[model samples]
Target: MSDSTQLARQVVQALLDAGVREAVLAPGSRNAPLSFALLAADRAGALRLHTRIDERSAGFLALGLARTSGRPVAVSCTSGTAVANLAPAALEAHHEHLPWIAVTADRPLRLRGTSANQTTEQVGLLPRAEVLDLAAGDEVDVPVGALLAARGPVHLNVQFDEPLTPVDDWVPRPTTARPPAPASTPEPKVLARGPRTVVVAGDGAGPAARLLAEQAGWPLLAEPSSGARAGSHAVPAYRVLLGTELAAEVERVVVAGHPTLSRPVARLLGREDVEVVDLAPDDRWQPRPFPVVDSAPVWRVGDGAPDLEWLDRWREAGRSLAARVRALLRAEGDVTPHEVAGVVAGAVGARDLLFVGPSNPVRDLDLMMTPPPVDRSARVVANRGLAGIDGVVSSAIGAALAHGAEGRTIALMGDVTFLHDQGGLVLGPHEPRPNLTLVVVNDDGGSIFSLLEQGGADHAHAFERLFGTPHGVDLAALCAATRTPHWRVESVAELEHALSQPAGGIEVVEVRVRRDNRREIDERVRNLRP
Candidate 1:
């Protein structure tokens, strides 16, 4: 067999041994050998193969698979701009600590700086990831094994010579599995019981924060993607409360994960009067501008029960705010973005998986998603690292495929976000389709900006053209073009009905609302008092 063919097979076998069950590939001439190897592996039932015409979508699809599966996922593409297209997904994976392996095909060393057809500096294309530059005859076992052992994303740039095709009937050998890494000891820090503390859980915090809060009888301010948002102590209207006088009374804050959603939370952490304790894992820590009094892997409050009165106070305030907000939403008469988010949250059961897009949809979910009841929990995911509104559709599709065969997958996004990665909806006839329901809140444009400073009356002159950027493409027609099922709902009841149906394949349910009331609604919400 040719050197390139042998190297490709070895690399694929190594990935399989590393426990990569899903692989996504983007087509190009340079990566033909790797493509053939991946197909062969799929035929052997070693891994599942997904093919995408767009490298960007393919990268996110792989990211989604890894995110939901809690296992490394491999994504391969040709050289040049195709490798660059994976940058967004790579950055996200690195920040979120997801296991993603990027395999890029490149020309041999002889083609360096020689005006090759699809050549660029592919070695350092993804600076955040550990890049492994390989040639045809180089040993692949060590580098591939190292990448598999690493926690985050890794890039493998392989150089192939003129003949990119594999030799006929070359079968890969069975891979040897490596022993699992040793688990780390949990060093729990003892927190002082005197101070009134609240647990702040951000993206990727998992359930540790929630468990700590429940045990300590402390209020939990968890972002929607935290997975710790449920439970009795979770404060639903934390954003508003953070801006209230009650937040001023906070004596200490225990933080987990990375909180980037609200300015109020940032301000709260910045307060010199309130001490902050961060319980982020060792590998995840980075220096921050805000002061953190203590940092550890786990934190345990000192003996004795926490002040139940303080917890009750915050819980009561949260309940009052939730009731007022619900009344206000009902008073609106027509369906609003907040209502749409609430209905979607209600529809999500313990077995369901939800991927929320960035911007207003995620923020709305943060504000409105009711805490799941006891004996039930839903896995909520969002790409909050850098938090850009790209690749969300493909990411959602990937999450759906990896989540399970029984549970339903739902994606909540705004019109602009949906349009940003509309290519995600395009699936080949032979490709695997997941049971996904995309809930799109269509307000004719970028309504999220309308709630920001850009929507002020003073900037109304430049608002519509610059920020709104309305693309009046009928979403139903867009769904039709992609051959996906589409539904348009205008009321809360209709949205609930739409979500109630079993999701068989990819589909879109568009919820229409007006953008004019966004600023007013936001002001009212922020100014609300218990």
Candidate 2:
């Protein structure tokens, strides 16, 4: 048996020992040993292996799989540019603090400067990742404890010698997962309850954010994907309310997780008069970006009574605008993006998974959806780490597959985002497909830019060509290419009816909307204040 085969098997065993039950593989030459080993593990029921032709998609698939399963997942690709393709996903994982493992096949040390094919210093490919560079013939003494303990990205670059494939037949080994090392959690601090405060729950902010707000009688400004959004304190149209007069009365903010959705929230946080108290624990990277006056591992309400009127005023103001928002939404009868987001978001049931994309879709979702029922679970997640519209389709699929069988998944993404990784729908007939309903808000172009400053009259002339970049592709035909089911709806009634149908497998619900008048609608929404 070649040493390369032995090393690959050891690496596979290490992954299994580390409790990595899912892996994505992009076929390549040098990584053949790893691929065969992964396949063997899959056959042995040690792990589930997913294969993708595109390394980029494979990385995100692993990312979403790990995210939902709450366990480390690995994506292996060949060396050189193939390794580079996983960089974007790695960067996203680093920022999001997800443990994404990248196993890249590399050429041995002897081929470093010898013009070897597909060999270009794979060690430093993922800058933010903790790299374990393994050469051609090395012993299997890896720091499994530290690797498992790392809550961020990890890169494992393996160098294979002349024998890329296994010379001997490999049998998968069943391994038991090591018990995790225990770590101490900080005692939650107490926040004095005098000042009027609101909890700002951003992406990945857990249920603690909601419990704190509910107990203290404070409004919760939770982003759509924030796990805390299900509680009674959550304010749905928070971005709109952020512009109201009541928002100016905020004396303090108890922020958790990372908030990057609206300019109004950013401006509110920037206010020097308002005290910012962050309860967010240190992530894999830097701490909260705002100028926080107080920081804690977690926080509980102090003895003094909270300002009840402050929260009531905010809720009243938010409720007052709902009628106006509905009026405006009804004024222009055609299916609007907000309506699309609302319909899709409202359709989610208890324990259902909702995965949104970056840009307007999530923002629209934020505006139109209300909080989930307090007792039920409706898990919402996004790639809010970098918030780029990359590989979202694949991520949603990965998430759906990992989601429990009790509930289904509904994914909301824009046309551009849906198109970005639409190839995710190209699954083999034998692949284990999940029951996921993917809804695409088809505004035809980058409608998000129109709501930004670049949409002003001064830049109107260049906006369509530069920012919009409209693509006239036939989406139904595109879905047809993969033999996936698709539905295109142009009205609210049509959308409701389409959503009412039972979703069995991976399907696309393309809600057609217009890009024009987006700025006008958004301005009206922002103007809806108490």
Candidate 3:
């Protein structure tokens, strides 16, 4: 038996033993041993395997799987550029503190710096991850230990020699029970309750944020992906309300997770006047960008309850703002991005899984969706760590597949984001398909920029060329190529109907809207006050 084959088999088994339930592979010559081993494991029902042609998409795909399943997912790809393509996902995982194992196959050590093909410093490709560079003779046990201790992303760059294929039919041994990933001990901190405060919950803030708000009787300004966005304390259209007079009265702000969605939230955090108490702590490389008056890894509500009048003010403001925004949207008299987001949000149930892309879609969701009174079981996810439009579709698909067979999965992304990872739709016939409904807001261009400073009247000329890049791609034809079901809706009625009857397997509903009025609508929405 070849050492390459033996190494690959042991690594695969070790990965399984280390709690990797899902594995993503981007095919290449150097990784043939790992691929063969993985395929054999899949055949024997040892773990689920996903295959992607694009290394970038494969990386994000593993990201979704790891996040939704709450399990460490392994993404393996060939040497050099293929390994580098995973940087975006790896960086995101690092910041988000997700357990992602990147198993990169590299050329043998003898090929280093000798003008070898596809061998450009694979060891340090992902600096954010805990990396272990291993050769053919290296022990797999130490690397497996790193995988077990991985709090965030981990990299295993293994070098394999020629004869990458297995010589014998490798039958898998019964794998041991996988251990649970260790949870961080909650750093206890008691926050004094007299000050007028609001709990700001960002992406992955979890239920602690909501519990604190409810217990302390404070308003919850939670972004959609925060998981704490529900409950009675949640304020609808909170971002818009942040500019109101009520927001100015905020004496203190209790923060959790990484809040990066809106400028208003950033402004609130950036305020040197407002004492920002953090619960997320400095988990990643960079500390919190804003001033942290107090820091804790996790928290609970302190001794006394806050004033009810403060909470009531936020509640009334939220209701008023939501009403005003709803009226304004109705007055638009045309199908808009916010309306589409609202329609999609309304379709969410307790058993549903929602994956939102960065940019406009996430913002639209924040503005339009009303949080439920109680915490619904619906899970919302986004790649907000770096907040870039890379591999969103592939990540959503990966999330949906790993989310199990119990509930429907819905993904909201803009046309450009959809185009960014369109290769994710190119699934092979033998690949496992997830029941996913992808809703694309086709504005023909990047509408999110239109709402930014770049869309100002003075910058109109350069905007279209750079920021407002309109791509007139026929999405229906694109969907046709993958044999995926597609629907194009232009009206709220049409959108509601389309969302109701999602084409079961893998489908897309493209809602067409115009970006010319984007800035206008945003300005009007901002002007709204409680």
Candidate 4:
């Protein structure tokens, strides 16, 4: 073994010892010495390594691992472009506030800045990060200390001195012990109370996410991505659902880890009487009502805290939508997004739902279907992270891969999102096949725009040009092109039949909803209070 090999092993061992167990690796020769060493360690039961060829994908893969395992996860890449590719993931982590160890391979200081093949100034690249940058020549203790002390992600640029591998029989020193501390429990900091407070759960949240909101002792305002019922337009406190009149007496507002909205919600926090608290990782957007309650692991508020009763109430409220959805599906008897989601909710042994977003589909589902029946067992995931029209397909694919292992994956996305990354559909036929039922609400135009303020104004022409950006794509043909069986439903009966049958491969159901009637459907649904 050589010095480089020894250094890599020591680093890996230190991270594992420090409770960083998962590693997502991207291949590269500059980091070959470390990569091989880490791989060998994994074989030896000293670590766990998940390999991805694309650094971009690998970075997100690492994030998914960390998100699921609830532990800081690390990513390794060989030098050069691979390191740069990790930036998107790093940016996401910075925003999502996930801890990912970005390990980049570098040449010795002498070789860098001389146009060395894989050498560039890799130091302090993530200027916005709460990082502990380390050099390969530095003592193992340095990276170890950084890893142990990291409140968030760190970047480690390793410069392996020539001779790449370290001699065998060398042992890395253990991390130094910390000083003893006072044993008294610190009181939690609580925000000012409100006469009526609502906890907003963003995308990627599950029951655990909702549980956090409940802990704050406030009604939950769930986005489609956040995975909760917006509730009946009538119910007051519980109905703090969409468009509910906010209270003048409410003092504080809390936003959990979800993406910011494209359209603004109530201006309660904007009022002089209200204060806003964001529990997200980064405050870069400087979200309005902008104080941050920076809690670790998860954020909690107040003395009695968010109670189980709130979560239970939320669950029951969700089931109300589910029941209505089921009843509609049973009555309509169709394979539309509504009927399919209805059948899925009934068949679902669990509450885990993977919603795919795009212009037409999610909105249609929102208007037509009730929430899934198994609310407590349900979780909703959407890539509203950036709310881009681009990644809906890939994001859905990723979510299915993440959660489909234990529960059913019912993907409700628009034809555009489906067509956007239909390549992701390839994963379905692979061994250990993903259990995903993709429901593509095939509205020809960009339907979501019609509901926005932008939709009703003179921007109509601009809307068609920018927001609508309609592409005359045929989803049924595309589904067949992928060898995935598809159903074309024009009404409720067809949709019900498509959803009622047992599905083996990835299934795509295209339901044609006219853009003209969307507003009417939305108004009817919103007016239908239980």
Candidate 5:
């Protein structure tokens, strides 16, 4: 009926046109007009709208929903502090390669930063965010359509020119035309099909996993965070398919997503007959041999026929693997590796956890932590999607905030992974979270690199200088400044004690593993394997 109403309707329509099927909104006065418009759209079945009270939690909730749906979900909030609260999740989406969209109702161009009730400069809050400012407009917006063209996350800041209202002659239209979002340019695919090709999904796996498997007709294996659910796609319960009776059958394998959720399984895939392919997010293409693939699209179309029998077999295999690992850990009686794993696994709650994947830490956890004798309880997590040690800290923090403190959150990372994003630990502190833990397996060097053929090479100096960056960072000092509690443990007993203690606020457990000693233990474990 009015210009403001028409503009509001167009803005909402623009979001829907940009693949924003899901919207999470927080109620407020300044944003009432935008809120009403979105609610009307939701009621009309034009979009799925979720309402939450806390803007910070609401922002993360939108992130989690986007993660589940494999689409760029939007979070709508009122002006001033509400917009400020979204910084945490936005920061996470940026670092973890998640395409998230946010619509914030702002104060008019004049009242900004003055003594206004709910008004602040929300425009440049997230500089890294791909911001699209839509000042109340009529006619179609093409740039909004282009914003959805890319696969990553974005922010759509809606600046209403005061007195918000509904659009004139509004009629709801159903969305029918669904076009194939372009796949990230594929990197040269490596690892030819062998006798048995196993596709492994580590932590934070998206829907693209199923598509890739269907295209290649390869058997899929997924870790917890790889986002491969138990009922759909590959039997995500295939953690048992590695390092046991079924190990020989897997002649070749592709490692998609993260491998940290099931470290034992990742190690099994790293064996002589296996070739690991790292798929980062569904966007950005970069494929390397056992390196990260950033360009693979993660949309969930053509995943697979529900292979119940296939999943059953993996479930059986997982049962056996769990038993074996438990027995071995019991026999060892809190060995160094086992203790380290206990500290991590024990500290984490049933919520979400992010595991940082490097050669040494991931491999050690694979050989240690005994999977529970019963059904899987705590979901083991890792960034096996394109498993690079970079951004591990940021990813875990994002996952924690994504799940929020109501659920427990923990991150198991190496010293190197922690060092990579040490600065990220204190990012956007205004959006505080209580349920977060950081576990660093400090061995002082790139021990995983040492396990490779490069260890014995004469270029020890060069390799150490390049890969094994051992900058001695004081964990205690960093924790003190950041308000994250820091604990140092040299023995298994101390580690157990630290793990048993409850985590208040954020906790960083620094477990010191001697590099030489870790190498010796790993060598012995390899000798013990068949």
Candidate 6:
């Protein structure tokens, strides 16, 4: 057997042994050996194979698969630009702490500085990820094991010579070695119950934040993607509340995960009067502008709970604010972004998974999504790491595939975001398609910028051309071209009905709305009261 083939087989075997169930491949000549090995592994029923022509899409697809499955996933591509394309997804994996194995094929070391056509510095290409350089004869077990242990994005730049083909079929052996036990986290810190505190659960804060809030009788200001945003303590109108007088009364804030969504929360953290206690999993503090009074692995309540009156005050104001916002939403004659987000959130079941796109859709969800019943909460995932709108469609597909047949997966993205990675829709007929329903809010342009300072009267002259980069691509035609089902929903009822139907294979449901009223709607929301 060829050395390249042997090395590829060994690496694939190591990955499978380390419990990698899914892998994505971007075709190239130098990576042929690895591709063959991956195919063999797929045929052996050891792993599933996903193929994408675009390396960027492939990387994000692997990211989504790993994010949902809670298992490591591998993404392999050829040398130079192909490997470089995986950087955005790799960076997201690094910040989100999702386990991803980046396997890049490289020319042998001798070709490093010798004018190789498809060669560049591929070893440390992903600065945030742990890098492992492998030659034909290098031991594969250690690096693979280390990647499994790190539980984040890891790079394996495997150098292959000419003859990149497998001579014999290789079957992977199941790993007998048990995964190492997770390190014991410190007990939740017992906080004094005297202060008027609220739990701020951000990004991957999970359910621990909700439990802490419920136990302490404090309100939970959880971001839409926080996973802890279902319980009664979860304040639905948190952003609005943060802008109100209620936020000014806050004496202390308990933070979990990284809060990067709203300026109000950032301002609250920056206040010298407010005592901040952070419960970040890692040593790095999230609220950098202000000093954290206490930083710990987890936080527990003391024997006493916070004043019930204080909790009641926040809850009452939040309930009132939410009612007003809903009233305003009801006044809108046609379907709006807020209504679309609400319908999407309401349609998702406990067993379902929703991948929210980065831009406006996620923010709309944050503002308007009715908190689901605690027992029936759907899992919400977002690319909040870098929060870029790239590869959202592919990510959603990957999440759906990882979720399998039992659960449905929905991706909520704006028209601009959907257009950004439309390449994700280009799946071959032979590839395994997921049960994904993509709900796109078609605003015709970048409406998100309209709500920002860029859309102010001062910048109105240059707004449409510069910030609002409108594309006139027909989404239905795009879906038709890809052979995916497409539905255009005009009303909330139509959207709800579309979401209620049995979802199988890939499909697109476009919700069209106007970009002109976005600024007005945002203003009305901010000005709303009980």
Give per-residue CA lDDT, model 5, range 1-530, as digits (tens): 55456666777776776677777777787677778788788878787676666676676656655554456677888888888878767765665566678778876666766877776678778645877776655563636655565455576677666567654435456655244466566444433333455567655565456455555555666544454433323542254445456566665555555445445664665576654555444333233324332233332223334444444455555555445554554455434553476556555544445454455565555444433322234555554434666555645554565455455666677787787667555634434444566778887767776766676567576877776767787878977887777898777777767766747666888887666555455454443422
Which residue runs does candidate 3 get wrong by more than 4 Å? 138-142, 180-187, 375-377
Better lDDT candidate (4, 6): 6
Q: TM-score for every candidate vs. truth? A: 0.97, 0.97, 0.97, 0.68, 0.54, 0.97
Cα lDDT tens digits, model 3, 267-383, are 988887799988666566347788888887766676764688989989888989999998999898889999988888888888889999989999999999899866464788999
For model 1, residues 459-505, the per-residue Cα lDDT tens digits are 99999999998889899988999899999998999999999985589
Residues 70-156, model 6: lDDT tens digits? 898999999999999999999889878888999999999999988889899898898588988888874544365686686678999
Model 3: lDDT equals: 0.88
Q: Which stretches of candidate 5 lie over 4 Å from their true place?
A: 1-97, 101-151, 154-224, 227-339, 346-354, 357-359, 369-375, 427-429, 461-463
Sort order, lDDT high to low: 3, 1, 6, 2, 5, 4
Residue-level lDDT tens digits of model 4 in 30-53: 787777767776666555666666
**Residue 193, candidate 1: C-alpha displacement in angstroms:** 1.4
Candidate number that wins on lDDT, 5 or 6: 6
Error of 4 at 311 (Å): 14
lDDT of 2 by residue, 1-530 (tens): 78778888888888888888999999999999899999989988899999988998999999899889888899999889999999889988988888789988888888898878887978888869998988645576656775688687899988888677776677666777775777777788889887878899889888889999988989999988778987667876888988878888889999888888899999998898899998776654255566889888778888867677888887777767766787799899887999888888777787788999999988988888877777764788999989999899999988998995868898999999988898788777767788888898887899999988898889999998999989988999999999889998889888888888846898998888988989999998998876
TM-score: model 5 vs. ground truth: 0.54
* Cα distance off (Å), candidate 5, residue 103: 10
Model 3: pairs clashing at backbone N, Cα or C within 3 Å: none
Each model's Cα RMSD: 1.4, 1.4, 1.6, 6.6, 10.2, 1.5
